[model samples]
Target: MSKKPTLRDVSRVTGLSMWTVSRALGDLSGVSSDTRETVRQAAAELGYVPNRVAQELRKNTRRSVAVITASTSNYYYINMMKGIQRTLRPTGRTAVVADIAAEGVYTRELEDATVQDLIQSRAAGVIATLTLSLDSVELLEKWDIPVVFVDSDPPAEAAMVPAITMDNFAASVEVGAHLAGHGYRDWLFLAYPSRWSTRADRERGIRHASERFQANLEVIESENDVESAYATLSAHLDHGSLPRAIVAANNPMVHGALRVLHERSFAVPDQVALIGYDDFDWAPLLNPALTVLDQDSEDIGVQAAQILTRIIEDQIQSERNGRPPRPAYQPADRRRVEPRLIVRRSCGC
Candidate 1:
């Protein structure tokens, strides 16, 4: 087996002293531009890659932010990730997704392990899609790794943590009101479990709107995936007649409801009106099209990334100033994005 090239190999190839080669490779000011270019070319020819682990050990920081998510298959997450990556690109940092619930299930043990891994890697920061456990939050805090929540909330114990989320309660209320306008008095809400903090507010808003509009509402919970949503709704429909309208809580739930309706030969808006929480690219291309509350998930991601970046920068500055590198969150950092309803054929419009 061939041995890997080292800094010394680049020095030997460039005929430069180790100190000069180190300065050139590090992009430090002591090396002239011409010398730096020569060293870089030599290093490139030697196939020498800097050991990031060693660099991180020396710097006590990381250039990659970890996005903690559970359901990567959801379309909303795809757009959100686009926003995060786009925003982080100019900052010279990268985003890495850590799926604690890769199997479509969230467990305390998995959350703990993910946090432990991030701590071990010296992650720069975190952007979470669901509320993390108190222990995980504190552990990240202790390590000076800031967290920014996107489309989710921080645990109550960590109220000061930054979060960028939509006004889910108001958005769900709008969805309910639109259904009421369509005379959908009997409504069924297919929701993911409350592990996602948005679920409670969304349900509350739906319930409030239902009572105000004199509608009867039922809420059913499912695991955070299409298959679970499909099975949950399928089982629900086996015993009761279809409601006047169905509200799907998110992308996967929308898919599940649509699948159940199609398999049961139920015509949308003719027998069962439908609405969903998040809008996706293909929403308009569906047979009946989809009426949805569009929550600018990409913008939410951008905002979360911006907030995390700012906090990380502050921590870096604090460390340079010989202070503890705790994340400095501001009241304004807990921001909410407004959601708008996108009307389409699915809701009898």
Candidate 2:
């Protein structure tokens, strides 16, 4: 087979200097439109593909932002990614996901390794879905790689870092209040592990609401995936009677609870009612439409991306000005989005 074409081949074919070819291909300011088009047509004819790794190595900058997350199977990440990608598109940057919990489990070691990998690649910025360890946060900060948390908070020690999260406590309170409105005296909460920062607040709100409404509340923890959710809830149900209502903490938990109920031939909102966090496309399509607290995950993702982009740009400008390129995080960088409960058949609405 023939060897792959390179920039030198494009320069040779276009009868232009390598610098001009590089500028035209990169769409930098120096190249005129006519010459840029000529270089592009010749490169296309020659099947020349720019080597991004080499380009980054030469420029000493990264063009991709890393998104740190766990539980890649969760549907919430899908819309969140859509928002991140859409926001990054016009900026000429890309988003790369690094799933620390690819096996449906999260470990400190995995988180460390993922952060190390991002640092090695010189990621421009990070948007994390789980609170990273303080060590990881400090390491990224040391490298001048800013992190913006989305749907999660930064480690408490790193308070100045930016974050965009929904008011999970209030959201959970609404969930509990809605269930209480249906007079669901015995309530079950299917929750993901507290490794996710939002879990504590969500559980706190649920507990407060349960006390306020005088409901009997049971909280069960599961790994952040559908299968684990199914197994955990199934085992719980095997030992006890179903509660009057179930509140699933997120998409995976919701799926798991629904699967267990369906397999057992349980009629939703009849003998038992169900509600979930994070609305998705198929939530309304289910036989008994799922009532959910819509966190507007996409908007959160957009805000997180925008925040990271601004920080990265600021760092770049600082570097250009011959200053230390540290992330300039302000108190106002911490933001919260409100969640709205969508009533549907599943919640006995």
lDDT of each: 0.88, 0.88
Global fold similarity of model 1 (TM-score) = 0.83
lDDT of 1 at 181: 92
State in Å the error of residue 292, model 1: 0.5
Q: Which stretches of model 2 miss by more than 4 angstroms?
A: 1-58
**How does model 2 score by TM-score?**
0.83
Q: Candidate 2 has which clashing residue pairs, if any?
A: none
Cα lDDT tens digits, model 1, 1-349, are 7999987798788888765775567654456789899998888888998766644442655588999998787888899999999999998999999998875789999899999898768789999999998889988886678998888889888889998888888888898889999877999999998988999999999999999999999999999999999999999999988899999999999998899999999999899999998889999999899999998898888889899989988977875774557789899999988898999999999
User: lDDT by residue for model 2 over 223-322, one digit each (tens)?
Assistant: 9999999999999999998999999999999989999999999999998999999989899999899999998888888888888888989987876774
Query: Looking at candidate 2, what is the lDDT of residue 203?
Result: 96
Worst 10 residues of 2 by lDDT: 53-62
